[model samples]
Target chain A: MRNWCLGVLAAFAMLVGTIMPAAAQLHVDVTQGNVQPLPIAIPDFVAATAGDETPAVNIAAVVRADLGRSGLFRPLSRKSFIQKITNINVPPQFSNWQVIKAQALVTGEAAMQPDGRLRVDFRLWDVYGGSQMLGLQYFTTPENWRRVAHMISDAIYKRITGEEGYFNTRIVFISESGPPTHRIKRLAVMDEDGANPVFLTNGSYLVLTPRFNPTAQMIAYMSYISGKPRVYLFDLETGHQQMLGNFPNMTFAPRFSPDGNKVIMSLEKHGNSEIYVMDLRTRAVTQLTDNPSINTSPCYSPDGKQITFESDRGGSQQIYVMNADGSNQHRISFFSGRAGTPVWSPRGDLIAFTKIEPGSFRIAVMHPDGSGERVITDGWQDEDPTWAPNGQVLMFTRSYPNGRADEIWSVDVTGRNEQRVNTPGPASDPAWSPLIQ
Target chain B: MMKFSNAIKFAAILSVVALAGCAEKPKAVPAAPPAPPAAAAPAQVKTSSIVPGSAEDLRVNVGDTIHFAFNSSALNSTAKATLQRQAAWLQKYPAVTVQVQGNCDPRGTREYNLALGARRASAAKEYLVSLGVSPARVDTISYGKERPICAESNASCYAKDRRDVTVVTSGGATS
Candidate 1:
């Protein structure tokens, strides 16, 4: 009886031991983590078949560039890549990526199909877990191989940020070059990463403040085409254009009403700038302000009923508000600094403006009631603040003191993540469009 | 576009300056003895040009100035007197239309300036309307502080830009 009891006890002990080891392996107690940009090592995609040169290498460079510009990923350089990604089934040397502080490692292999297509098979591995999170493969034409790489980057960004990737988006702005006095402005569009820059409007005429319609295919801007400053619209897909209205005076600072169905602008008639809204479909005009003050730079609220514009009627340039139908006008900005160029965010969360304080000017954001004002950027001259599609960032133009040139820059809403975007020429008046789903 | 029309526009602009050049004190011209209201009817049919010295010239020139009361859109007694003189000129032409541009001193909100400028212009328009002058012969535009008479920044200068001028828009011929 005693021997039988001991035998049962021993079996129970063995079972507990087995379960204990499994539990220890499954449980992880990490509460805090590296919140910094994820360090990633991208191995060159091994090319199975040569294309043009002696041999075509992997598309790792394209992937690396895409990830680096995301402002969220730090890709390790190839010079430090410990091992080549030659096989799909081989496990990565996780220790090597760790030595280089790469929290994530991506490996891929390229093969040429008999049908004259290139197939890229890739994998993403979590360095800390020593496990694979994703394995994806894409087939594309050799000429479009870059797209395949961008798709890979999108997948990685989505998995990490839990947000849709903006890799394939396009940005349109006024391509400005030359001195401020002789500024040659043209409409330019390019990929969000400053690639494939295409000039939409030639620099023959003066163009200022190009804003993208919600569709990203239409642009409304102020142009001196008819020898008068007026608002004009251009269709990206149709390549057709039309003037906004036949107003007698110069119409400056034109922006699309929230719905893109109307344009809100300041019309300077008889040297008095007053806000006016024009219906796109009906060619109807509604005057929002009858007062004589220089009421320019009209921006509609998200709901389109109220418009905030800059006026010097009170002696100094300040912001004012009024109804869409031009009633119940009131003062909104009691701040000391001079505020001009108020732009309402798409989300209706904040209004961005350029405040000229003392001898300096800065870009700032404030709540609708003119409270909780905060300046986001400062320089010799930084104006024309436009928000990104997601409201997560803002882009504006900054010119040096000497007024040598201007460049477009972007900064995250937190005031961090400030970076200058590359452009072929001096770019200004950057208007971010809604995400082109 | 030859010569940019600069001379014609400049001369008309000069008269506007000249009208504004008067004084901070409001002055009134003699009323044209109530022209029986029928004479003012043909005055409404004419397309008066705002040339510097035309028969319909009503605009004050660039260097000209007008004054408003403290926070008041009502033309002061002095300003009313000036409008009287202005009214006599409008009656003498009989074929002229004029625009009264009203401005305000820089001590209030811009919306108020816009409203105030309108009120000041309307006040002048009302006086002209009261002077047996047909309202149809006059128009009003308020340029809050956008077109200041004085380019400098001081109380004296601010006071100067805070006034209005009458621009002739009908029968006029000036070199």
Candidate 2:
């Protein structure tokens, strides 16, 4: 530990061109706090300008909502604040926050700038140590108040949790209505908290499995536009839709590469489906698997060198992994039930999937090598699992046996904090978007 | 092309007439067709892009649908027999083009069921081609578990849902 501190101090000295004390006092042991919600205080942000009081209160309210919904932090009520702060420039009154049982405090200020953008400044403080944990400022349009609030929440989250925040992300899913047998499926996008949902395509043609590329502003999904299933790419900014490429008979379950330059999906020809990758720039398609059995739902490892997917070559469905160039194909999931729709975590440690047993379909996670398998949800019929960008949460669809009431639900990776993600109505096939840039 | 059964058509008209009576009905799910309303006289009406000819006759006589086992797209002897009959019916109207729609039970993941449904449709198309039907005349599509013939969550409904049906797309003339 001393050597690590000395090494860090040396690196810091080189960056600052000065010698510095080697002190290692910054670390959060998050492993122990899994079950207990962190106690925090979010006092109403003070308005720098006299007329911007309402926006300041809203900014603090949004941060509280984002953190509260995550189930990680419990924001103490503003009624318990013992000290009234009028500005964020001064250090927090740590003794007052400590008396209220708040281990952390988040304070900020907002003002309307001359150029018409709202300037939001925030500081996260540790009550015990009397230290500023995080501080940042953002300039955004006046209409982008929510975005500025999300940025502040993200910063506070990172400071306390030692992980990236998924608050600024989005979700792409299939919104369903009508009868169970003949439902109308349309593509919809929304914020991580189910706000500002925009239906991308009308129900003119059926769409399925909308996967967003974390590295770019693109969505690869399957559509039945030509009376047959094929993959299509939708540009988020311009809203241009185009067929991925002129491929074989059918293409389904399209997922983007980790770098967003290629798409790995399944192509069926002559009654056989296999995995394939198509380069987005050249439109060049390459066959990854030539097996006679079905291989689909291919997801890339975080490093973009390996792919994990499901295949039926051995008999029933099981998860398999292969190189990016389609070599060394082997099975990763081998259990009593059938596993499909395997998704790798951004941290590259675990893979989440839908596990089917005798009468139930469950959402489960396992190590990359298929050990430490645990079911996160005791779901009656949960399918389509997606990781929350931070790799700490999994969201999937839970439905009754009749396929009537399908709703998206989320659970922490440790199998606790299970809750429903509210949407407009019956929604399915949710894919999480990467953290907003 | 889409085809509506006469039973469904009559039920549609009946529901339209009864709409005034049950204006306050809490219809969360559309009332499903019960027992298909029996084999009424064929509608013989043009709807969507459908034309009345061999497709309607084949649905009534030779049975345009073939059932498969759970999670298995392989054709059994009974399925082969049904495909043989469908192949003969198609040979009667050689100019007609058809699409075999494949479906599955509501037990598996949505995307895999789509691929499985595709396999089932292609299996039916291959069997038809083997029985002397022109390969170019048959196109295939898999609705997966999306368009189930039965909506219940029982074994019998699942059995009915895991099947493929051949629908005539073009070149069928009314006679």
Which candidate wins on lDDT?
Answer: 2
Candidate 2 versus truth, CA RMSD in Å, comes to: 9.1
- In order, the Cα lDDT scores of the candidates are 0.68, 0.83
Every candidate's fraction of true contacts kept comes to 0.00, 0.61
Tens digits of per-residue lDDT for model 2 on B1-175?
A: 2245555667778999898787886759977777665678886654433334566766766678999999899999988988898888888778889999999998989878988998999999998998888889999988888887777788999999999999889887663
In candidate 1, which residue ranges exceed 4 Å CA deviation? A1-35, A52-59, A88-91, A108-122, A134-154, A300-308, A313-315, A319-332, B1-175
lDDT of 2 at B81: 89
Backbone clash total, candidate 1: 36
